[model samples]
Target: MDFQFLGGASEIGSLGLVVRDQGRTLLFDYGMTPTDPPSYPQPAPPTIDVAVLSHAHLDHSGMTPILSRLPKARLVATPVTLAVANLLTRDALKIARLEGYLAPFTTNDISSYGSRATAVDRHGTFRHRGIEIEFTPAGHIPGASMTLYRGAKDILFTGDLQTIPTHLVGGAESVECDVLVMESTYAGKEHPDRKETERRFRDKVAETIARGGKVIVPAFAVGRAQEVLMALASSGFETYLDGMARAVNSIYLSAPEYLRDSKRFRHALDGVHVIEHPSERKKALREGEVIVTTGGMLDGGPVLYYVGELYRDANSSILLTGYQVDGSNGRQLLDEGTMTIDDTTIRPMCEIGKFDFSAHAGHSDLVRFAESTRAETVVLMHGDRRELLRDALSGFADVILPANGPSFTIE
Candidate 1:
């Protein structure tokens, strides 16, 4: 089998991989880095038999819509993944337009996706033209999956895995394979205890509220926002949700099977206020005790609006709940004590805080999960510090640290 990475082999964004075996060609994921102008993977090969999406995250499923143009390629993912991916891809197009960047795929391409897509359940198998692939939960978010391709050699591709369970989903399940392709996003890092972290987060919220100030939590719409909401469910704060996360919540609610606890999930949303339109922003600003909005990195979205109104208020706070990529506004705030909104840099007088609500498995967790796979060859991808994991796994397996645009063969 011949394997190659088009991108995201040495870094955490814009991930793609191609595998060719026994006259069949497969693409694992094709994604783009959602930065200022955005960065994309190499153009896909002219022909492909199947394209498997492990999750709906933009770094994994952003470019799958373009695959609809390929006459013979069939896109496969869990039903929840397909629905969420559709929502995200459309949102990406709108963002591209607002930012004055030409989107790679047309709206028509996204609409045609349903024709080319095959919705496989998390525990189901997909087979076409002698090609076989199986799905298992990845635990980063609800409906996220790790794919197993049963070819000449059983190869398992883990797309953004988390070994520890969160309020939204269970931990990733292990499967034995000959070759294991795993993500190393936290290759040299370990998260703080989840329960402890949540306690601190809620305590901070209460402190801000007790001080007669509103808390603005900027979170990623897909997984981070929902996780934060679940954490705040019992607090009885006047929480108001905003941005694309509202739409994402609806999709997750429709697919109850994808969530860890459907009843609890619904109960969590019941007590909170939903900002249905931009016209309600002022009402939320005046009434809400905690506002959880989208654009997790503080790069773009309704978060800017809330920050603009509350930045000068020393009593208010902006709490970030996701990874801040380099050059993002959130990183600037943490590093320089300032952020830019609409081309104007502003130093916020509001209190600033960050919590570890990350969904990726850390260094020790990665090593344990890799060992449990029992694979002879371990290929690590999707992190800047993958060497840390490579060294850790050296004695247990033939650890291969690959770079983008390179091909390696293993039999």
Candidate 2:
């Protein structure tokens, strides 16, 4: 058996890998680079029988529309991932346009991706030709999953995982495998207890509110938005959610079992203002004491309007609750101690705070996962090198960190 690391080998984005056993071949992910200009990798081989997606993150599943043009390829994913991915692809088509065309795939690709798609749950398994596969909960997003493939050899691919219990998803599944392909999004560091992190987050918000300044929490519209809402509602302050959170929350309410505290989400959301209009967003920024908005990286969202106004005020505070990828306006704000909007660089007089309420496991968690899994050849991907995920896996002699285009024999 042989595996090709097409992308996501030595980087945080565009993770694609192909697993071949005798006459059959299967690929994983198929994402584009998240940075500006949106890096596109080289083309794939002549054919692949199946394309397995573990989640709906742009990095792990973004390139599916691009790759599905390869003849009669089939897509395998969970039901919610398909729903979220369809929305994500449509949005990508709208946003990632170049010269009046989406470089990888068009709206036609998004629509066709659903045609070749099949959904599987935790206990369900599928067989393509001779290879057997299992879908296990990844404990990341609503429908994120871990896949186990067994043929001449056994392999486990963890797309992006979180073992700890969160508001929306269950804890990570401990499904065993012989070759563990895991993501190292958070490594070489310890995370604060979810309870403590939320506690600190509330205290920080309270402090900002006491000083008569509104609090801003910029979040991603996916899983992160739900968690932030739960934290704020339980924090004893009036919290308002704006923009994409309204529409996404409605979808999340459609599937209640996947959440640990569906009642809490609904209860916490009661009386919570859901802002979608621009004037309301500005009014919320001007009047609301505490606000949670999506577009986590602060690239462009209602949060920008809040930050552009509130950031220059020393009494205010901005709370970042998720991972900020490189080149994102979030990182630029965090690193530069200032951000530019409409060509104006505004120095933030507001206190900037961060909480490590990361959904992904840290270094110790990854090691524990590796030791428990039965996989023989472990592949590490995801995360920035500054997180030291690559170095942290050095202790595992079986671990391989593939660069783009590298191929290895899985024997």
Candidate 3:
């Protein structure tokens, strides 16, 4: 079997890989690195039989439209993933146009991608040419999957795994394979206990509301936003869903089985007030309600508008609920005590707090997964801390850290 790391080998984004066995070629994922001007994977192989998508996150599915050019390339994903990917792709295009950056693909390409997509269920086995493929629940998001390929050799590709269950989805499905390709997003870090983190998050929201102050939670639209809303609702706090999160929340309701507790999730969605327009958002800010909005890293979106209004008010508070990438607005706020909006930098009087609501598995979880799988060879990707992950998995298997554009053959 020949395995090639196209992208997502040395960094946290642009995850892609190529596998060849028995004269058959399969592409795992073709995503783009999330930067000011996004970077895509090197050109795909001239011929691709199938392109398997693990999830709809931009970092994993951003460059999927590129597959449209391959006449024989058929996209394999879950129903929810295809639905969510379309929404996210359009959003990415809009952002690129607004920021004066050239988009990698056009809307027509996305349409072609959709027409060629083939939805598969979890654990269902399918064969294209000489390769057999199966997808299991990854527990990262609504339609995330851990892909398994059986060809010349058994290989497993874990796309952003999360061992710990969240309110939105259950934990990852543990599977055994000969060669394991895994993500190490939280290689060197340990997340706070889920129960304790939830308690603290709930308490902070309640306290801010009790003091007649609004609590703004900046979360990712897809997974983090839903999880935060569920947490807030379960804790007896009234939350207002704003920005693209409202649209995402509605989409979540369409696929009930993808969630942990469909009824509970729907209840939580019903409990929150959906802010549809700028006027409604402005009105929501005037009240002391807890608001959960998009732009998790606080780079843009309705969260910024909320920040602009509440930053000057000492009574309000902003709660960051995810990992803030370096040089992002969230990181700037956390590190330098200020947020830069167009041309001005604002030193907010309101309190700023960060909570580890990460969906990726932590260092301990990664170690446990590797030990349990017991693969002969393990390759780590989608993380900056490769050394930490290598050391942790050294005792379990032969750890291989391959860079982009290299093919390692298993003998």
Candidate 4:
């Protein structure tokens, strides 16, 4: 089999992988990085036979809409992934227009995707013209999956993975394969204990609220926002939620089978207030003790509005719930204590903090997961520090660190 990456072989975003065997071509996880101007993977080959999506995160499903235009390409994902990806891709288009950047696909393309796509269950097998792929749960978010392609050789492709269970999802389980293609996003890093982290996060929120200040939580709408909401559930904090996560919540609620505990999930959301419209944002600001909003990196969305209004209050706090990509407004705030708003930079007087709520496996966890897969050959992708993982895995399997745009044969 011949393997190649269109992008994201050496970085954390703009991921695309192509595999050719027996004259059939397959693509996995076409994505784009939502940066300042945004970055995309190289255009997919028009001859692709099948494309599989692992999840709804922008960096994994961002570029899937364009695949609708390919004559021979058919897309596959779980029902929940398809629904959430539809919402996210449309929102991405809106953001591109608002930011004045040209979008690669149109609403027509997104609208056309359903006709060319098939919704598979998390435990289902997809077969198209002799190409077979099996889906397994990937713990990053609800409906996230890892695919094992049955071809000239059995190849397992992990999109983004979390080995430990979080409040929303269970831990990812390994499947046996001859070749393993894994993500290494946290290759050189280790996360803090999740329970301890949650305790500190709740404590900080309580402290902020006790001081008569609102807690502004900047979270990613897909997974992070829901996780934070569940963590704060049953705390009687009078929390309010804003942004596209409200839509995602509806989808998740409808597809309760995808969540770890559907009943518990429903109960957790019951106490939180949902802002139904933009006009309600001011109300959320005025009445909420804890405001959970999106654009986790503070690059855009309702989060910027809350931060703008509360930055002057020394008693208020902004708690970040995910990785702040470099060059993002959140990263600027963490590094320089200043953030850009409408091209003007200002310092925030509010308390700032970050929590280790990452949805990817850490260094030791990655090693252990890879070891469990028992693959003779391992290919690491989707991380800047892939070499660290390569070194750790070299003794167990032949490790290959492929670069974007290069094809290598695996035998």
Candidate 3 versus truth, CA RMSD in Å, comes to 1.3
lDDT of 1 by residue, 161-202 (tens): 999999999999899999999999999999999999999999
| Residue-wise C-alpha lDDT for candidate 2, range 357-387, written one tens digit per residue | 6778777788787777855667777655523
Off by over 4 Å in 3: none
Residue range with the least summed lDDT across 10 consecutive positions in model 1: 113-122
Count of clashing residue pairs in every prediction: 0, 6, 0, 0
What is the per-residue lDDT of model 3 for residues 1-411, given as tens digits with 9 covering 90 to 100? 888878999888889999888888888888886666777888889898999999989888999997998879999998888888888888999999998999989999999999999999866776766668988999989889999998766889998899889998999968999889999998899998988998898888888888878899999999999988888776666678888877777777888888889999988887778887778877787653788988988888988888888898787789999988887889999999988888699998988899888899999999899888879999888888888989988987999888899798887
In model 2, the clashing pairs are: 177-374, 177-375, 178-375, 178-376, 179-375, 179-376
* Two-way TM-score contest, 2 vs 3, winner: 3
Could you give candidate 4's per-residue lDDT for residues 162-266 as a string of tens digits? 999998999999899999999999998999999999999999999999998999999999989999999998988989999999999999999988898988889
State the displacement of the C-alpha of residue 150, model 3, in Å, after optimal TM-score superposition: 0.4
Instruction: Report the Cα lDDT for residue 200, model 1.
Output: 97
Candidate 3 has what TM-score?
A: 0.97
Give the backbone clash total of model 4: 0
Q: Give candidate 1's TM-score.
A: 0.99
TM-score of each model, paired residue for residue: 0.99, 0.93, 0.97, 0.99
